[model samples]
Target: MDLNKIHNIYFIGIGGIGMSAIARYFSANGKKVAGYDKVKTPITNSLEELGIRVHFEDGVKHIDLAFLNKEKTIVVYTPAVPSDHQELTYFKNNAYTVLKRSEILGEITKNTFCLGVAGTHGKTTTSAILGHIMEPLKATSFLGGISENYNSNLILGDDKVSVVEADEFDRSFLRLSPNIACITSMDPDHLDIYDKPDALQESFKEFAGKVTDTLIVAEGLPLEGLTYGFGDSAAYQALNIEIKNGGYFFHVKTPTRLIKEIEFYLPGRHNLMNALAAFAIADVYGVSSDVIKKQLASFKGVKRRFSYKVKSEKIVLIDDYAHHPTEIKAVEASVREMYPGKKVLAVFQPHLFSRTRDFIEDFANSLSKFDEVLLLDIYPARELPIKGVTSGWLMEKMTLQNRKLISKVNLSEEVLKSEADVVVMIGAGDIGLMVDDVKFRLEEKFSLLK
Candidate 1:
């Protein structure tokens, strides 16, 4: 679809991170923008402040009459939205030029130099770090999560280059045409859609084939591409890693030269690998090694990916969007590495019912790594609850003795009652909404102790 003819863009689920990025893109380009979300969030509020109309109601009346014209208006919706959504149905029945959020993103990046970062894990951080590296080139980044450095998911810049998190959910990344693509990891996830792990891997292989230019794969991903990891022999690698002042000071071996003493603020070996993938993309794009190192040091992480809420000595609280087993394992390893011998408490809210059922054993094993575990009822973002697949079921499978199923109402209280030195809230669901409450209560409790 030729975008020039479209005058107005209406979003059915604009509050979503990816949808909002595209909404901002259209609004910035002088198109009349408005959207309907089931709930209003800080992201939707930000859009409203930008002169874009946002309504929380899911009714068709909330949509302005100006967008009712099928000829001049374009409709975009997230796959998360139900098929029976009134506003979405109205657009479809009226023959409006409706497109999925990914389709719109594909259209936007088709003519530009697109850099896509894809994986079951680490895609957001990799894309964010890559965006930082390509800042000198003024690349527009449509991130899956808000970057702490940019404070927004959409990084507006010239159309010379675009950086995006190629989401594997619903195989949405297939729509993108990237000049340089990086696959951070191809872990099995979203089993509800893929039905099996092999299907997910095949989808990734197909995605690998779509890379218009260079394809950078993480080490050991069964695909043909230049690899990046801690291994010295990898095409791009981070070696001789040392911890200084709670940050990683490491040397990266590029194909041409060995870049030394790069400073990275984030924790976890997984993050070092994420930075390596981004560095490889920068190198492939001909960004100088010195500039990559400099930009990487200043690159702050994404909002909820291992975000530190309280970093004091008395009580440490961190929040992360780690619903997957591998991601939770990464978070646990980072916490243990940073505060060795400390009693770590992990509060996890399972994201989807199918996911909970698919990786029950893996989830139990990962959560058991913590000293104590608090499990919240499944978040059920886009799935109906699977019978017998509850948090209690998961808790029972866990090897840890100090584990209990808790509700959001009792989340902070349970954390305060635990004898843990470090608290980490891990999930991709509404558990993030409780971070401030948990942090405030923990702070108050620690202050009273002092």
Candidate 2:
């Protein structure tokens, strides 16, 4: 579809991170933009601040008259939206052009030199780092998460180059045509959609086939590509790693040369690998090693990837979007590494009932590493509860001695009861919305003790 011919773009789920980025892109390009979401959020507020009209209700009357013109308008909806959604159904019944969010992203980046970052995890951080490195090249980046550096998911630039987080949910990444791409991992996730781990692997292989110029994979992944990792066999390897002052200082060996004294601020070995992946992609694109190193050092990070809400010597609080078993283990390792000998409390909200049921034992084992655990009810974003999938059931499977199933209303009280030195709240759902209140109560309680 020729986007130039479309003057008005209406989004059915405008508050989503990916959808809002596309909305901002069209709004910035002088298109008349508006949309409807089921709830108002910070994302919708930001869109409204840009003069884009957004409403919470989902009705035909809520849509502006200008967006009703079928010839000049197109409707974009996310896969998470229900099929019976009123606005989406209205657009379909009226024979208006309706497309999935992934289809529109594919169209937007089709002609550009696209750098797609695909994986079950680490895609957001890797893509954000690559976007920062490519900013001088005038690359427009559509990120899956808000970048702390740019403070927006859409990093505006010229249309010649584009960086995007190629999502694997619903096989969305298959729609993207990338000139250069990287698969950070192929962990078995979204089991509700793929039903088996092998199918997910095959999907990644299919996406690998679509890479026109280059495909980079993490070492040990079952794909043929220039590899990046800490091992000596990788095409791009990070050597002599050192952690000091809560960041990493390392040297890198590229295909052509050795770069010395590369600095990156994000914590965790998983994050170090993310940085290496981005560095390899940019280096292959002909960006100078020195320039990439400089950008990596200056990169802040993506919001909620490991955001520090409150950091002090006496009390520490961290928020992260780690919903998968592997991701939770990575966060646990990072916390143990950062605060050695200190008691750490992990307050976690399981994301989906199917996911929790599929990996119940794995989730229990990962959450057991913390000194204390407070489990919240599963945040069922797109799925209903299974027969026996519940937080209490999962908590019973955990071996951790100091674990309890808690309610959101008593979250702050339960958290304050723990005398742990550090508190980490991990989830992908509305637990993010609860972090601020938790932080405020923590500060107040600590101040009273002082």
Candidate 3:
């Protein structure tokens, strides 16, 4: 399908991070853009502010008349949307040119020099960093999270190059034809879709095969590529890492050159690795080491990827989108490294039932690293609840002595009771939406004590 021939673009789940990026892309390119989401959000609000039509209801009437013309309009929907969704069904039954979010992205970037960042974790940060590094070259980046530097997911650039989060959900990355790509990890996730760890690994290998120019992999991953990590044997290695002034200062050894004293502000060894990946990709694309170092230093980071909501001498409040066991462990390590000798409280909401059931023990063990734990019910983003799988069950498996199963209704009250010096809210669901309320209450209560 020729996107140039299309005049109106509609999305069934336009409020999603990825979907909204595409919506903004079309809107910026002068296409009549609109969509339907199950609910209104800050993302939907932003779209409305751009003069794009958005409505929460699922009826066909909510769609503007311009979008009803099948010849000129193409519909895009996320895999997370229900199969029976009214707007999606209407578009399909009406024989509109419908495509998945990945398909549309594939179409947009197929002809460009696409730098696809693929993995279970770190995709968002890695892609955002790459986008920032490549901004001088006019690379359009469609990121999975809000870049703190740009304040928007869509980093609008020219048509010659594109940066994208090569997602593995539903094997969506398979649709993209990339000139260069990197696999940050091959961790087993989305068990509801893959059902087996090997299947997920196979998908990564398939994506790696699609990279036409270069494939960069994290050190110790199963894929064979120009490796990047802290180890001496990796092609792109971050050596002599040190933490100072709330950030990392390190030297990177590329295949051809040694980039020295690169300063990165994002906390965590995992994030250091993410920076390394971005640096490797940009270096391969012929960006100067000095330019990559400058961009990495300037990149603020993606929102909710260890975002500091409240920070002071008395208390520190952090919000992160770490629903996976490995991600939680990374967050825990970063917190412990940043604030030693401080009592830490972790409030977690599991993301999906299949994921919770598949990795319950792992989740419990990871959360146990905190001094205190508050477990909320599973978010169940796209899956029905499984019998006997719940937060209470997860709480029982945790080794933490100070752990409680709490509800959102009483989140602020329970959090206020904690004597912990650091409070971290971790999840990928509406719990993110609840952080402002929790932050407000925490500030109010703590100020009274002062």
lDDT of 3 by residue, 168-258 (tens): 9999999999998999998889888898659999999999999999999999998888999988899999998999999999999989878
Off by over 4 Å in 1: 448-450
Model 2: pairs clashing at backbone N, Cα or C within 3 Å = none
* Cα lDDT over the full model 3: 0.93
Best-performing candidate as measured by lDDT: 2
| lDDT string, candidate 1, 259-279, tens digits | 888999898889989998998
Residue 306 shift from truth in candidate 3, angstroms: 0.3
TM-score of each model, paired residue for residue: 0.98, 0.98, 0.98
Candidate 3: where are CA atoms >4 Å away?
Answer: 448-450
lDDT of 1 at 335: 93
Tens digits of per-residue lDDT for model 2, 1-450: 999999999998999999999999999999999999888888999999999999988789988999999999999999999899899999999999999999999999999999999999999999999999999889999999999999999999999999999999999999999999999999999998898759999999999999999999999999999999999899999999999889999999998899999999999999999999999999999998878989999999999998998888878999999999999999999988888999999999999999999899999999999999999999999787788889999999999999999999999999888999999999998999999988998888788334
Report the poorest 10 consecutive residues by lDDT, candidate 2.
Answer: 441-450
Q: Which ten residues in a row have the lowest lDDT in candidate 1?
A: 441-450
lDDT of 1 at 402: 92
Q: What is the C-alpha lDDT of each candidate?
A: 0.91, 0.94, 0.93
